[model samples]
Target: MNKSKVLLLKNCSTGLVSQVMTLIFQFLTRSLFIRYIGIELLGVYSTFTSVLSTLSLAELGFQTAIVFSLYKPLAQRDEQQINDIVNVFRFVYDCIGAFFILASLALLPFLKYILTGITVTNAIYLYFLIQAFSSACTYFLAYKRSLLYADQKDYISKIIDMIVNVIANILQIIAMVYFKDYLLYLVLKLMQVIVSNIWVHWVCARLYPFLKRGKINFTLLRSLFSNVKNIFAGKIAAYVYSSTDSLVISAFISTVQVGYLVNYTTISQQLKTLIAGLLNPITPMIGNVLATDSEGESKEGAFKLYAVMRVLIAMMIVVPFCVLINDFIAMWVGAEYILPASVVVLLVMDLYIHFVHSVNVDFINAAGLFREDRDNEIIAAVLNITLSILGAKTIGLAGVLLGTVVSQMWFWFGRSYVVFKLCLQADKEDYLKYWLKNIVDGVALTVSIVFCAYLNSRLPIANSYLKFVCSGILCEAVSVALFGVFHFGDPEVRKMLKYLVNHIGKR
Candidate 1:
């Protein structure tokens, strides 16, 4: 087995545990949050986070750039180069944090105009300030965490996050039960943020004890800055993609609508984060491959990974949306919070696009292909913002989501093409052939799973938990069968299946 792949799996395993912990905690906390903060403040909290996400453009993609930069130097164990990269990022992050605080303060007063139909609270500005402080602490001190990731120690950070999240959330949940104050809940969160940041900083120091602060080398910094510029654009575009729906809905519709949307979105985001954990560990490993592997090998490996991921993720997403989401909303939140099928479909499509983006972006970032797709990212962002505002004015929530999906389609193609042609140096046919096959396989799996879910739904299952379980099992079995047949000819699929069988036999 490849050592790097082993490390990736290890990180993924730990990350998975963390995400499961998070999901459990979040589920427990949601009722308390809704009770204490009420639906309106919940909307305010959602809007606040969205606004913060929008302003995170100040992060300027240095996280990606610095992490990308460290892959090579860390591979060589060149402490000097690593130190320079860290210092460069530290300096950049410090400035970014300071700038964000200033700009957000300047913009806070205008949120009155920006967010309509939402009653502003006296503690609103205080909430913003505390959240900003949390964000600033993260930006200024979290740069070292990237160093750990580049060194394949991301499990450390994930573990720390898990512990911090559990402790902080338990305390916050208790505070909410008693005080029912958003401000106090946020205060608990702020304390947790500071603790998490400090803990990670300490971990980095312990891991790299020999390292000390140093100025960035001019030449290396300039080269890295070139990559950072394009990455910054992409980061801004991504923030807009993720944050715009709440902003649009809060402004045009109502805060209550935003609350309703987030009820479903909370599920979407949790699933997204959980599944995304599986991809994160592999990304820096992808950078290693792009840096070291031959062109043909890199192309073949990337295509296989992307194809497998697409098939797996499609089955994961589409089946749930089909069999589970409607009843899920009814059981989890309420039927009233469930949107029209048209809107849910749009939301699922958006989720799918972003999910696949994880795969595309890994290769692109790994190959340092930022500049090639920078213009496309900018255009996508512009189109999304413009169309979202216009569409929301006419049609409301669904229209805003549709605008995002349309814009994602715009640049998703560009990013994939650049990865195939520019990064992997492969033919368009090389990409299209496998991509088409994987998408077809995924669609087939989705149809089969949905039918299974339909049949499962007809059975006498009064308990929603039992219903979810029955459907989940049926979907998985059907998906496995479909995947096995569709990918019978692919070596990667065969290898993984054989490994699974052998492992099971051994067990």
Candidate 2:
């Protein structure tokens, strides 16, 4: 295997492990929150967290742009350049942190509007403030971790992140169960953020001590700031569409309803995060390959990567679609707050679009076309917010999702296609042909498996648990079989599989 492949595999393995642990932790945390705190408090918690996330605009797009800038320098093993970049980025991060502190403080007057759901209780306000402060601290920590990621040390980062999250979540569950206090829960979360970020900084510093030695480069500072301007604007726009939706919903809908919406959104977002963890480490590698290799080699590698990613995305989409998430939610969180069927369906659709968007967006960002990417994000944000609000007012949550899908067609899909074309210098027809083939194969396989699972639901199962277990197993089995037979049977996929088999056999 080539060095890139080896690094990809290492990162993927560590990422998968981290994702699994994180998912488990999330499940436990969600379960505890639902059972102990109930939906009302969960709503308050969710809204507060969402507000805190928006405050994370402090880090801006510097983290992403900085990572991209580091790829070539890191690849060339230019120690001085790496040190300069790191130092300059850290200095910027501190400025951003200060900005966040000031922003958060300034937003206090407007907290009543933002925290619309939460009562004006002193304790609740304090909890929200603490969450906001924690979020600010986390931004600085994340800047340090971005250096590690850019250096292709994501495996190390992932391990530390996963371990910290798992430990923190366990403590959170204990806090919820024992104390059942929302303030205590928020405090625990704050502690988690502080500890996790500190760990990230510590780990990165240990791995690359040279980062700590560099003098600030004003020239690098100017360039970093310039790139960050576009990135920051893009992130603000992205957050508008992503995090702002929840805040908007909280504004119009009941807090309990916000809680329900957040729960479904959380599941969908977690799934995305899991997929991203698997694919994201390779993004910088893609940039590095494009920067270092011939155009043909880069295109070929990208095509292969896209193909593999589509298969992984198929698994991500179909598995959740197949499992009766409504049943799972009912079982997990109780039927009292079970998400409506329409809400669930809309959530799934949103996730599908989101998955596609992620694949294309990562490629676009990796290609260093931040300006165009930023423009697309601006369009997406405008359309998303406008449509979601209109939809929510007219039709409700499903309408919000419908608006999102409608917005994506022109804004996201069109922009992504253009980015793909521009970055890879590949023909539009060729790209469409590949994706069309995957869509057809994936749809057919998904339908066949879902049909099989639907039939199994007709059978008499003694218990709900057993039925769920059987349905899940049946869905996965049929999907894998159908995908393998129809999709993996393709010559290219087969060759890759055979190579993997032989490679593993030798190992």
Candidate 3:
């Protein structure tokens, strides 16, 4: 396991530790929020988290710009360049921190307007301020955290975040169980975040001793800011995509519905995180490879590994969600919280499409292709916003999600063309055909698995828990057996499998 495999394995391992802890915490805490905290406050809590994201938009891709800059220096082992880059980033992040505080306060007057059905105004503001301040702490002095990832040591941060999240979530649950005070629970979260930021700064110092002695100059800052400007559009696109729906849902529908949406959102988000946890480590490897081989002569092999990974991960999540979301939701919470069938189907479809789109995006970002279709991201964001608001007004929640689906047409087509042309220097037809073939294989295998599972008489059960468990296991087993046989029969797939096994065995 060298760079690519090593990075992937470590990231997945550490991410699993954090995700397992988070899943446990979320299971207990979400149930508690519904039972003890009421749906309205749950909306407030989730809403403010969204609001904090908007406020933090002032960050404006500074950290990402810094991380991208870091790849060159880290690969070259140039300590001074690394220190200079880190220094400028710290100053910019500090300014971004102060901007967030001011921006959040400025929005306070309109907060009640954005949120529907808010009775306790002061509590909302206080909670918003606390969340904002706690988040800002990381920006002020934590810029050095990028080095951990650039050096492929993200496991350090992942482990730290896991410990903090586990402890914090546990304490918050206890506070709710004992006091049942929303404000108290929020306060504990803020304190835990503050502590985590400080701990991250300490870890950064311990890992990179050279960071403490560096002189910053505008020349360096200006050079780094160019990367920042290039990637800023991507940053906006991501934040807006993730957070704007909350605003729309809060403004148009009742705040309570936003809480209900989280029932579906929680699972979607966790699956996305798990996938990212596995794939994100490969990004730096891609960057390193491109830095050395700009012609992308290395891409065809990488694409095969990525294509297989995309199919496996996407099906592992989407097939189950499509087949068993209703049953899972009914068993976990209740039938009452489940959305309508239309919305459920759309959500699962969105997850599948979103994951497929994300596969190329990691490569695009690694190749510094953000500036290629920066304007198109603006178009997509605007389209999503307009369509979401109108769709929610016309059809309902499913319509709102459909807006996001429609907007991704650019990603599936436009971005792929650009990456295939500019970065990989490969034929667009070949790339498109590869993806088309993957979609066909995945869909056919999924249907076959579902039909076989149904034939097994393991589905359509009366009991919710039994239906979810039986269908989930059968779906996974059948899908694996079929997909494995389908791909393992390919010489290319067999060659890659042998290479991966040899690499890991050597490690």
Candidate 4:
């Protein structure tokens, strides 16, 4: 395999491993916190974290833009340019951190108004403060880590992140189990953030000693500032649409409801992370291909990746695991906090739509077409928030999901398709034709699998667990076989699979 492809696969593998560890840690943390602090406090905690995540827009899109901007220069082995870019990013992030601290402090007076469902006794202030500090530390750490990603050294970064997170979560869980104090838990969380940042920076410096040689250059700093200013504005708008829904839900609904919504969203987000784990390590490789290869080859690779990602993500998202979820949550968190059926269904649908968009969105972002991408994001965010509010009032939580689907279809998808076409210089007619064919194939596969699963469900199985396992296995087996016989036999699918198999064999 080529060096870039090798690096991409290695990074993807590491990222997948990290995701598995992180998911396990999240499961443990959620289980322990729900038990130790109960549902209400967990709701407050979720709200606090959501607010903090929204506040992370303060760093703008500089972190992402920096990585994309640096990739080509690094590929060219332009050390001076790399150093200059890194210096500028570091300076900008430091300023952003300072601004976040000031803004968070200024908003203290209206904290109660900002954070709905927070009680005086819930230590909401302390939670926000801890979260804010962690955010600041993360901003700095991210600036340094972007260089690793730009160089496709993401394996290193993911490994460090996985180790730190696993250790820190273990400590946090131990503290919670032993102490069961919110303040102490918050402190441990903050300390974990600090230590993780330090470790990331230390590893980064050790890996690239030249990073330590780079001095902050003011002229490059100004240029980066100019580039990032508009990017940041666009990112803020995107964050509003992406991250503000939970806060709005918390404001309009109850904190307990937010807790339940968070549970469903968390699962959806986990699926997203899984998809990202599968796709993201290819981003820098995409940049490398675009830099060093022919446009035709690059476009071919992009299309294949997009197609496979869509199919895999759809299968992961659309399959009705609701019965399994109901059982799992009941067994895990008890029936008291189990999510409503409507909410679960809504989340699943939302995740399916989101996954479709996620697979293609990276193509635009990694192509350095940020202006049009940002414009689309702004439009989508406005529509999403507006519709979400309108929908929430009419349909409750499901309305939010409906709003996301509408925004995605009407705003994000078309724009993303346009961006992808422009980036790859692909023909619109061909693109649509391919996607249409894939849709037909997908529907056929889905229907056949569902039919088999339904038939399997009628079997007189004494054990629900065994029945679930058997049904799932049967569905997957039938789906794969049908897809291979019908869809995978198509020339494009066969070609892509051959390419993948050859690539794997070479590696």
Among all candidates shown, the one with the greatest lDDT: 1
Q: lDDT tens string, model 4, 205-235?
A: 7776676446788776566666676688567
> Looking at candidate 1, what is the lDDT of residue 41?
77
Query: In candidate 4, which residue pairs get closer than 3 Å at backbone N, Cα or C atoms, i.e. clash?
Result: none
- The TM-scores of all predictions, comma-separated, are 0.87, 0.85, 0.88, 0.86
What is the Å distance of residue 285 in model 2 from its true position? 6.4
lDDT winner between candidates 3 and 4: 3
Worst 10 residues of 3 by lDDT: 452-461
Task: State the displacement of the C-alpha of residue 432, model 2, in Å, after optimal TM-score superposition.
Answer: 5.7
**Which portions of model 1 show Cα errors greater than 4 Å?**
1-10, 71-81, 210-223, 281-298, 301-305, 356-358, 423-446, 449-453, 480-496, 502-507
What Cα-based lDDT does every candidate model obtain?
Answer: 0.79, 0.72, 0.77, 0.70
Candidate 2 lDDT over 1-507, as tens digits, reads 998788778888988888888777777788888888887777777776677677777666777778888999998988788888888877887787778777777766775675555665666667667877787776566677877777767777788778778787877888899988767777878887888788888877777766665578998777777777887867877677677667767776556678887766767777778777766766777778667766565555665556555664666465646356777778877777676667765666566666655656766767767777766777777888888888878887677777677666555466656655787677778778756865676576557646765667695887998888787777777666666666655666766677779999999
lDDT of 4 at 181: 74
**Of the candidates numbered 2 and 3, which has the greater lDDT value?**
3
lDDT of 3 by residue, 1-507 (tens): 578678767867987878877877887799788878887877877887888887777777777777878889889989888888888887788788899888878888988887888775687788788877877777875676787877888878888788888889888988888889888887888777777777888988887888765566779777767777767777777776788777788888768888888878888988888778767767878778777875566776676677676776777677777777776777777778888877876777678778876757877878867788798788788888899999889987877888887787666677777767777788868787777776677575558546754644545568756666777777777666666766767655676678889999999
Compute the lDDT for candidate 1: 0.79
Estimate, for each residue in 300-388, the C-alpha lDDT of model 1 and write its tens digit: 67557665765667666766665667678677766666778778878777777677655677787677677887888899999999999
Task: Single out the weakest 10-residue window by summed lDDT for candidate 1.
Answer: 298-307
> What would the C-alpha RMSD of candidate 1 be, to one decimal place?
3.3
Please give the lDDT score for candidate 3.
Answer: 0.77
Better of 1 and 2 by TM-score: 1
